[model samples]
Target: MGILKILIIVTNINTYAIGNLETGLWLSELTHLYHEAKEKGYEITIASPNGGNVPIDPESLKRFTLDEVSKQYWNDMSFRALLENSKSLNEVESESFDLVYLAGGHGTMYDFPDNETMQSIIRNQYEAGSMIGAICHGVGGLLNVKLSNGDYLIKDKKITGFNWFEESLAKRKKEVPFNLEAGLIERGSDYRKAFIPMTSNVVVDRNLITGQNPFSSKEMAKVIMRELGKLK
Candidate 1:
């Protein structure tokens, strides 16, 4: 088979008073997807709401949190370049990828939901028979994407994301832009989640794959790879 073309969509956040400290994609999540896809000879195209240099949560890069693979991937010259030169949402065309994955972080809540460019990319990919996957707050991006038939793309599908209980436990309840689990249910999706403590959890429904948190990104990408290979 030929190379797999994968598109990773991230958020671009800018806090008015924080200087350049705004957060974008979580490093662990991107590390998971990037390495897994690269090992399988997949070409990656990263896009964001505003594109250009995307920011990352500095805390996520600390030595205690990330594994060696993640640490190495983050510092690689070529990989770093991809993050620096990401395509803007408006620059992505649906026909370019075989799969589209949404990487999550706190910043996603603000931009991913209402990005018309992203919604169009999802619609076009699904219509063209490509796989769609999101993890944690990344699923927030799918909240408003609709199909040509006038139905929410996630409607009636079994999906999972950062749960309400987890949010409460994080003590960041109010800081969250919106309630992810509740929003999924409100849209008629079968929102299911694992118990508290936010353990490793992943939900795959047909072509849609949703992982509960950054901890599940590796497994999530593996699942996506398996599903895409099956199609081939």
Candidate 2:
């Protein structure tokens, strides 16, 4: 097959709903997937719901929390420039990709769901046989997606995302607009979780891959690579 064309969508929300807490795209979530895909020479296109400067959650930049891969992208001015101007979902409607990745940040809780464009792209992409992946709150983008027959995309798919407890552990209970864990279960999704809290957990259900949190980025990227036939 030709090189896989990847579409990565990030959030444009820069604040929390309750306290206006600073939040945006989580740096590592994007970087891990980016570097892993870059290594295999897969083409990546970054976009957001609004198509402008993507906000970086302030907390994700804490020097103590960044991994080697995340740090590498942080120091590269060229990589940083990508977030400065992302394409809007409007521009991506006509495009088809081999993989559609949604990068998570707390800000995603503010905008990923109930988006007509987002739901349409996901439905179109998944139906077209593209690999669908999302990490942490990015999974929110998939929450409201319904297929043509009116079935939820994740209804019977085993999936995982930033759990409610993880949000509590992150001390963001009030900041989040909804309990993601409960929402998934409510939608008939077979949601799973990590054995431990604040750890990496990635669940694969056929074409869909969902990660538990920012910590799940590395493993999620590996899964994406494998799913794309880049790994054994």
Cα deviation at 70, candidate 1, in Å, is: 1.2
Q: Which stretches of candidate 1 lie over 4 Å from their true place?
A: 14-22
Question: Best lDDT goes to which candidate?
Answer: 2
In Å, residue 39's CA in model 2 sits off its true spot by 0.9
- Regions of candidate 2 where Cα sits further than 4 Å from its true position: 230-232
Point out the worst 10-residue segment of candidate 1 by lDDT.
14-23
- What lDDT tens digits, residue by residue, belong to model 2 across residues 105-172? 98888789988999999999999988899999999899899999999999989999999888888998
Clashing residue pairs, backbone N/CA/C < 3 A, model 2? none
RMSD of each: 2.1, 1.4
lDDT of 1 at 30: 80
Q: Candidate 2, which ten residues in sequence have the lowest lDDT sum?
A: 223-232
Point to the candidate with the largest TM-score: 2
